[model samples]
Target: MTFIPIAIYWIIALWGLFSRRPVLVYLFFLSLPFGSFAVVPPALTGGLTFVPTPMTAMLMVGRTFLDPTILMRAISSALDVRRLGLLTGFIVTALVSTVFMPRIFANRVMVIPVRGDVSTAAPLFPTTQNISQMAYLLISFATVIMFSQILKNARMQQTVLLALTWASALTVATGMLDFASQYLPVAPLLDPFRTATYALLVDVELTTGKRVVGLMPEASSFGSLCLSLLCLLYFMRRAIDHDRVRAFYAPVLCALLIAFAWLSTSSATYLGLAAFFAMAALEWIMRFLDSRYNLLRKRYLKAEFAAAALAVVAVAFIMLLHPAILENVSMMVDRMVFQKTETSSFEERNMWTYVSLNALVETWGLGVGIGGTRASNSAVAAISNVGVIGGIFYFGFIIQSLLRSAPPDDKRGQVLIVALRYAFVPTFLVGLLIGTTSDFGAFGAFRYGMLTAIGVTGLYHSSRMRQRRIAVSPESA
Candidate 1:
């Protein structure tokens, strides 16, 4: 199933290499997971078996971890090369282990499992896992910027924007479908849609009914995506213009994503959404102040006003439909300020933050090596003891970059860039502060790539926009 699409990718990679396009190489590398697992697999897996079970999709998605296997297989078949480095590596490692640890082997040695919120004994391509994880971390922040740059130079910007808009729209739609199917009545003997829909809606809980992950990875991830989409839509509005009729879908998508997130009953995710909303709101307020205080020129003020108003109306509608924002905020207030523990999440985060802080004391300067984030038996211990300081440095680099790169343009642009910059910082803090409670953020390549893409892309676009503004500005006169 993986071979055919992989063949096409190899062809493209060769073509890209032949063309001497290093960026294409980078993009091709960035795209392997999404391409092999995300795009081409439907035809491959769908064709292999008449029935496309959820497990197949999961397996394909899971292949992101085992990309080394895919790479090796592709190399051996396509290049017909024998004894690739990995084979030599396996032999050398096995020899070293067998010779040095013969007694260890005689004891029927057991492999100590890596601690994490979740664990799977099944091996993924270990090498690919590491490579992809790093790639994602580096690439996520660049994607948006690159796309924006491409749009700036190319006539294809409209098509690209439409594609991205559509992808986000579909994600919103699928998530809503998942949410609605959850609440709607199920009839077993009815048609496939009715039966399948009913099955998706069944109530299930995790951690002894303490966690409800919902259709998304977790409720919080779903909420974050929804909230991020809303922000993205607002940000992109100036770039793409359309009739008022189609513009309505933007708000509708945000509301639907939030609604589904609420139904999932993910308190942490809701908290994340609230944080995002607050940041966005603060941006709006800043823009308003700038407009009032002569901080922004009269030229862009009207567009800013329209954006702020649209954002507010959309948020108001979302809040009206799902009042959980208040409920979640109240729960947080009661817990944090009032000094009461309402849920495990609250308790876990606090514990982890303490531990992480202590860990920072021990490893204060240089960071712990890679795999430092490997889970500990306890969340707090894992965070603080297992290289807490290093994590801080890692996150600090991100925070500092955000602070430094934010556009210093008109008040509106400054506020918008600053707000966007701070958006993910809090989420990262939550994962850190919340402790080792779970491996929510650092688990897979896809999400890591996503974060990197958002960060890099945002920074790149802001710089470009700033340059463009300067290039044409009257200030140069």
Candidate 2:
């Protein structure tokens, strides 16, 4: 079964890598939902299950590195210099932490490993996890450079956008099928796709109904996937090139991803959804203010107005006419968010964060290294794995990217810069609650790269399609 999925991935990966078109862009985005499908079996990797997206990321990095000019161009810019510097500092911290901190605090701290019996935290030690996690961290860091370089070309940027739109649609479709298969006799039919060595929590449930794990190993991951896509698609829709994709496909997929995430019934997803609403509201308000006061309006401002109006009408209708809908929503939120601490899952996850944070302090802030501990919080996971210096470097990179001021002429760059910033918040907030590793995974690196490419090129001069100018025959100026 694993072989079946691996073979399919190979075809996609190979085609993407070798093709003239930006197939690798499509491959990267489409491969993300298969969190449970480990491309390399644990037995082959000596207990490390290398999943598709990370493997694809490594391949993308390798492919990018093959071009000597990318590094040449990357290093020429001050923004790229800082990005590389910060990431270099981050990796150095991880290396030092993996080598020395694990040994220094080996028996001194307790942690729940990313693998092994996750039921309880144990005294930390040097393990294979440290090595594998370092590799993953390296791959993620490399991905930022790889993708940023790739996005320098206008065609590649458009391809990535299209790929994300399609990937979101595919993700929603697969999750819906998974949800429907529960009532049908076809649940086992989909099992072949979920052959990862990790324990698959596909059929977990809350008090209401079966949690929609999709093809992911667990409900939280599946929900997070949906939430991330929803944010990306909604926030970055204007950057998409095609009218059909931007106006119809992306919007429909966003609605479906939102619906599927709700069905997943994850507490983190609920919090993320709330965060999404808040952030979207804040962004819209800011844009509105910018348009009214500063004359710094966005390209598709009317859509935001229309969406906001629809949301109000929908909410009013749901409250006034379909009161039961509001009651059900309230109960869901109650179970998932307000009363989340009461659940055993919450207790277990809480322990993971507690022990991870303790490991941080226990190591005197040296950090126990990546994969030395499992954490339910991204901040705890990031800082605890690499210590304060590494944490600062990692977070500083994010802030730097967000703070980048694009040239006034680069409209696409400016939109992507602002959109990606807001889009990251919902998912990052969710990761703070249930994230396991310091790695932001591939999609995050992709977003970072997209933003970085603008900074890399400085003015997006490689873009051939941004112009609709008709030249006058006589006038040179």
In order, the Cα lDDT scores of the candidates are 0.38, 0.81
Candidate 2 vs. truth: CA RMSD?
4.6
Query: How good is model 1 by TM-score?
Result: 0.49
Give lDDT: candidate 2, residue 79: 42
Best by TM-score: 2
Clashes of 1: 17
lDDT over C-alpha atoms for residue 267 of model 1: 50
lDDT of 1 at 440: 27
Candidate 1 per-residue lDDT, tens place, 109-129, comes to 221112333232211112222
**Stretches > 4 Å off in candidate 2:** 74-81, 291-297, 456-477
Best candidate per lDDT, number? Answer: 2
Report clash pairs, candidate 2.
none
- The RMSD of every model to the true structure, in order and in angstroms, is 12.1, 4.6
